[model samples]
Target: MLSFESAGRGILCNDAETRPSIWCKGVQPALPLWLASHPDCTPYDPASADEARAILRSALQALYVDHQAGFYYLATHDDTCVDTGPLHRADAQGAIKGMYRLRFTPEVSTVSTASTNGNRKTPPQIRLCGAGKALQRVLHAARLLSQDWGIAAEVWSCPSYTRLAREGRAAARWNMLHPQSRPRRPHIARCLGDSTAPVIAVTGYAQHIAEQIAPFAPGRFVALGATPQRGTAYADFPGAPWITLIALKALVDEGALSAQTLEAALRTYALT
Candidate 1:
């Protein structure tokens, strides 16, 4: 399980001497996949940021079992905004090992600047201004209530989350008391909250962080996110619900992550 205990100083190995909270959470699955695919590349191909984000979306569908209620939909980060020029290092298993991975041939491409649908078809979603602030708000809230629930959590992975304490001056409180000063940066894995029960369940690589959940701690429920792709072979999670909240809605709304046919697909993925 990924614990925040070792997260005090930094999660990423390449952090500056000053040390920052690695906030390793926001990283998409493609990061590890790139590391695993190439052994000879010095810096590793860094162009698949989109593929990683897309993979995470798929993983969320496979991992989070909504029961009757809808699971949370998240992130949907703008692909064009991510700077894939940089590299991160990873161990043999694809776990990020150092600050930099060798560069590699990118399989993902940039979004075309060409014209397309230009409108808002869905309800306006809400998120923190800065990823750090969101992390600070969510984690600080979790920590303050820790003893009450015996649920322990710490900053596991992210530079955005680290900046909250170091730069955002976030307090150990929920959004009610410590309202943010800025908007959250775009990324799906902002922060996670959990209790002694499966208050929040995750899928895919995210499930790896299941170490932070209930039966281990306490809370009514918690936050969650995931990483996925189309096929079940290269994607899908262990015990998550078949259909996802995103895909379900996508059907009627003509959105991408609709839930219409997802239930069947989910059933298939689970059976497989």
Candidate 2:
């Protein structure tokens, strides 16, 4: 029951490669691969917000003892914007793209960010190109999920309701991408083909070297940074928990699971 298929792509909020948990069976540990170390080194293509909070306050002061030994550091941009319950001063990436001088201070702690739009649960936005305002901006940032956290930051995003742009994926499943073409399907691997999860083919594996698949992050790995070996491309892995309380269940903190806490934990696990 240990079906392993390594070959990675799509899932970048600052991908650092982390795969395990029998191979990410339900993926959502605040989409982690590793991001807790920084003195300053930004990488969020077309970035801003005081250069992303001085590289996330030096990546949370080098994890200041893993955040007082509590362990919680999530920072995703996926497209910088603001609105916690009603635009906290609608800081459109610095009052509409002045490019950095960010704000989201409650004293910042951490949660998760950017991941929701296999069919909308929020965090889908990428509009501001032509500026008519419909919202859309998940082009990848939060140093791609605090890639090597260095902190002094304040940003957690999820934009896009038009023209779809959840930017990339850390986890997605809904009939495997479940696209019926709404505003041209919100690219979660282009809404898969037809899936119930448990489908594999993966062309052949290793797009050069990146195949650090992290389904549970036991030994965590995913460098999936090269693809195009020729046809047969298919990947939707996450199923290998023969039992053990469904395998000790871990990895689920995408910033406190919004989408109303993952729909009330799937309506209370569908009433158990």
Candidate 3:
């Protein structure tokens, strides 16, 4: 019975100022599991088992029966992540479940090492896609590495790669001015004017998941996941943090991300 409008944002949503910098959409338990890896943010109490059960019921029912598709946002504090709003949902068949957000611990500073010459500042954002369990390693890595790298990277917990691909294709179709017309502005393209930071995508699935959805967003996109060497095995839980660091460094080295920003981040932490 959730309205399309209400499902997209969720109830009791947090204001931008009050909301945690990173959060999840689908599962309620991810918040605490993520917190456990970062000892600094420990002593946390995630949603109760009953609350988790309710959310799972509402979400899975929507997906299987109603085919309601959306990513719900969870409001977070040092103690817990309260369910708030839906991120993106559709009231039709092919609805996928699982979405969540994560907040970077407040104590960790994600700052660039360079001076902004009178320009407004924006933090880098990364969209992580996969089942909640799949993204946990990258999430943990992003949290710890962001601080050491001096980049305050924002993490988006994406549960449905297929849904993103579908959304991107539809967006491209909608952006078409004519059959032969080049796309002037695709609907999902991120605005460079709005954010200068590159968006890195980390998932434990096939690399195509990121490739399939790249057209929708504008910023530089870097995807990390299983390769031929790794086969299909999901990344080890312990290696996720450093793996995330490696990816970030790769992006910076490739010039996909601003070297200045990485340098700034390094300087901030005196890692240089």
Candidate 4:
């Protein structure tokens, strides 16, 4: 097992003549693909300190108990300060087995019913998936969605988008080859099989990082990231406000919310 940690606080030592400089960027967008390019390499990124500890324990099990012969790459960042509580204790035992799966955050309700808007019928709920520091923003956005728009939002912590995409591709190939056999469902499909709600996946890296799972995501899927859109200023990451706006736009497109509601959100966020 090969483990690596990056502060995601891009820093460099220029020379003896100059002070150490900061690059102010993270490699998350490219690191996944770089690691995936190698044979037998499995990449995992934890959103919080507890998740990291759980992943470390799982890695040890994979190495010793399972006698796994492949390369395990555990990539972590030091830029964010996450709670070290036992939030993931219940899921630790199955961490290794479901390394590629998305876990529901504590904020998500176990209830299946969607919240209605005023006297109108309930609108379609939306799912938000994010990893690393971006997960924090997604959680905040989830709260705002319910509080401000009466939109039911579920938050999921995705530890490995690369793993999910890889498994999804493998399932596609297998199903193509065995047309008469029961089709194998990918991790993404199994995780989101029941919900037809729109999925808005956010990442601190480039948009492409989250777009990786778009093809496999059920129903409507939107990917958000650090990259700036045309005519918009560049940002290192997308925050809760931006995420909320995007969700409103998706709701408008689905006819769950009126165009006026989306326009009001855009104005509130100063996105227009």
Query: Evaluated with TM-score, which candidate comes out highest?
Result: 4
Predicted candidate 4 versus true structure: per-residue lDDT over 6-120, tens digit per residue: 3221112111110111333424335545665655666655677667667666666766678765556555665663342465445553344333333433343323224454344
**Deviating ranges (above 4 Å) for candidate 1:** 1-83, 87-169, 172-262, 267-272
The TM-score measured for candidate 1 stands at 0.21
Error of 4 at 104 (Å): 7.4
Ranking under TM-score, best-scoring first? 4, 3, 1, 2
Deviation of model 4 at 49, angstroms:
2.1
Give per-model CA RMSD.
19.6, 21.8, 12.9, 6.9
Question: Which stretches in model 4 have alpha-carbon errors above 4 Å?
Answer: 1-21, 24-30, 79-90, 93-120, 228-235
lDDT digits (tens) for residues 117-194 of candidate 1: 743233211111112112223333233223222222232223211112222222223333646654432111223223
Candidate 3: list runs displaced more than 4 Å. 1-100, 104-106, 110-130, 177-194, 228-238, 250-272
C-alpha lDDT values of all predictions: 0.27, 0.24, 0.42, 0.65
Task: Kindly list the per-residue Cα lDDT of model 3 for residues 8-120, writing each as its tens digit.
Answer: 42322222212112234322323323322322221111122223344445655655567655434332223333232333333111112223344433233524434467543
Quote the positional error of residue 199 for candidate 1 in Å. 14
Candidates sorted by lDDT, descending order?
Answer: 4, 3, 1, 2
Model 4: how far residue 66 lies from native, Å = 3.2
- Name the regions of candidate 2 deviating beyond 4 angstroms: 1-51, 58-62, 65-67, 70-272
Q: Looking at model 1, how many pairs of residues clash?
A: 55
